[model samples]
Target chain A: DQQVKQNSPSLSVQEGRISILNCDYTNSMFDYFLWYKKYPAEGPTFLISISSIKDKNEDGRFTVFLNKSAKHLSLHIVPSQPGDSAVYFCAAPLDTGANSKLTFGKGITLSVRP
Target chain B: DAMVIQNPRYQVTQFGKPVTLSCSQTLNHNVMYWYQQKSSQAPKLLFHYYDKDFNNEADTPDNFQSRRPNTSFCFLDIRSPGLGDAAMYLCATSGTGDYGYTFGSGTRLTVV
Candidate 1:
């Protein structure tokens, strides 16, 4: 079963505009959420993360909003750049255990047009 | 710079042949993980090592095995590769606590 789901397979946005990627999970035990950006042929790079205790977390142009009630989270990029075009993956652990083994969504390919 | 490194960016192996992928980390983290990612799919956890202890996913096939002799190095051995086994293999490392994982570039495996 897919515990985490990214309903959107792809997204397109103009440069200097805002880009929003959404993810949802069915597991209630997941307390931490993370977003990772991946370029073609490269490993995923960590972007932003949010804990269950917080509703939102921001880092520079990237912001992650979490809603425990909905079991959903989103990544927002303000003034999106061409460099931001890549596959974005949302991940969370199965439970709040010591292993921290992550389960990832299918991922959304973000295209930022210059 | 301290990072996770995967050897052989690409590999082509014959069907039913044995192949091994190597990963080494300079981060000296306590945990190392192996992930398999098919085209346009998210990375799937295969196994991991917490220091000297190894943990395998329940669904991981018996054809796949892993070894971590020390903190710095890990290996993924495919006893008999199948066409369906072709995918990108990623290596990652992380320290205990609430830290994000560091992933290697990934090795693309192609079975012929």
Candidate 2:
């Protein structure tokens, strides 16, 4: 069973518009969630993270919302720029205590058109 | 700046041959991880070393092996590469926890 799920394989948004990427998880034990962005042939870089205690966390144009009750989280990129096009992944630590080994969702490819 | 470095960005090996992918980190983190990612799939954890302790995932194949000579270097050894083993191998490091987890650019492996 896939613990972390990114149901959408890809998303496309016009530049200057809002792009929303969604993720869901089967493991409610996960207390923290992270978002990562990867360019073609490059390693993924951390973008933002949200604690389960909070409903939302925002960083500049990027915002992450956690709905614990729904077992869902969404990453919102406002005024999405063409540079924002990349593969996005949602992840959570498998063992909340250790917080090292992560369970990742199949990434969503975001395409921001200029 | 501190970073994780992977050698031979691309590698090609014949089926049934042995291959090794190397990773080095300047972050001085205590934990190192190896992950395999196939096309459009999630990156799967193979094994990790926390200091000198090695932990292997139950699903990882016996053909996959890892070596951590010291704090700075880690290597992934594939004993007999199969066509199904073709994928991108990513190396990552973290401090005591996952907060500063950093990943290398990954080495794309092709088993012919």
Using TM-score as the measure, the top candidate is 2
Task: Provide C-alpha RMSD values for all models, in order.
Answer: 1.0, 0.9
lDDT of 2 by residue, A16-112 (tens): 9999999999998998889999999998899999989999999999999999999999999999999999999999988765536887899999999
Weakest 10 consecutive residues of candidate 2 chain B by summed lDDT: B94-103
Candidate 2 residue spans exceeding 4 A from truth:
none
lDDT of 1 at A57: 99
Give per-residue CA lDDT, model 2, range B3-109, as digits (tens).
99999899999999999999999999999999999999999999999998999999999999999999999999999999999999999999865653699999999
Candidate 2 TM-score for chain A: 0.97
For candidate 1, list the clashing residue pairs, or say none: none
Which pairs clash in model 2? Answer: none
**DockQ of every predicted complex:** 0.63, 0.64
* Per-prediction fnat: 0.51, 0.51
Q: Highest DockQ, which number?
A: 2
- Model 1, TM vs. native: 0.97
Write down the lDDT that model 2 would get. Answer: 0.94
